[model samples]
Target: MSTPILEFATDANNPCMHCGVCCTHFRISFYWAEADDAPSGWVPASLTEPLNPWLRCMKGTNGKTRRCIALTGTVGQAVRCAIYSQRPSPCREFPVYLEDGRPNPKCNELRAQVGLPPLPELPIAPANDPDGTPTEPPTEPPAAA
Candidate 1:
């Protein structure tokens, strides 16, 4: 299903506080071709060592429990994507607030840490049935805005 774009307030009043928690916890998967297309800054420690060419997941180290290799920054510092411009397709398409209308745990955690209320749910498709067929089509959120 196509992901919805969550509109964020972009004025100076809505500046990112830079807690750096999201980049530390999420797992970002990248396609092999996308990894190859990464820019110079996106090079991780794993890429420097000899390894199999067909590998998929490159686990993060040092404070970041298990995250994508491309994420960089120490805890309490400004977290940033090494390849912000040339990020992988998944990174480019990440939901700003929700993933398939479900509240992303990482995002929710960050919001709660900052004392913000939970965001409203978005439209999303239901999970598949036992036989592997989709249970239902996407539905719109309630009109109470």
Candidate 2:
């Protein structure tokens, strides 16, 4: 399913701080095509397990947390996908939003967990970021109840 671009303003302060929460919190599903290519240099050198063509589940090593093997970087630092450019199609399109041009509620949950205020409602679009990540809708600031 192709995600339509929602028109919304970019939050200047909403830069992805690379908290790695997105990677650690979710099980990144990979496509068959992504597994065909050789692992990137950034992939952990110690991991010799062959990529499972039908791999579906992803969990952190040593019971740390659930995350994609391509996710790299230190906690609270710069975290990013090692093979971002060549990431699987599913990985390239995450946080699926509604077709009505509304932001996915799940995204708000993520921002809250990451210490970010709710984002303003915005349209979704094909993220053209250099990282090749998908563009998410701008969430509204949490209501001041």
| Candidate 1's TM-score | 0.43
My TM-score estimates for the predictions, one after another, are 0.43, 0.50
Where does candidate 2 have its weakest 10-residue lDDT segment?
41-50
For candidate 2, what's the RMSD? Answer: 8.5
lDDT: which candidate is best? 2
lDDT tens per residue, model 1, 1-145: 0122543333111112233344455555555544543453343435322224743343552334654455565533334556555554555564544435455555556655545444444334234233443222223221221
TM-score of 2: 0.50
lDDT against the true structure, each candidate:
0.42, 0.45
Q: Cα deviation in Å at residue 78, candidate 2? A: 4.8
Expressed as tens digits, the lDDT of each residue in 24-136 for candidate 2 is 66655543334434454322323323346554333353234666566776533455566555555554465434454445576557656756555454433333343435555
Task: Say which candidate scores most in TM-score.
Answer: 2
- Where is the poorest 10-residue window by lDDT in model 1? 10-19
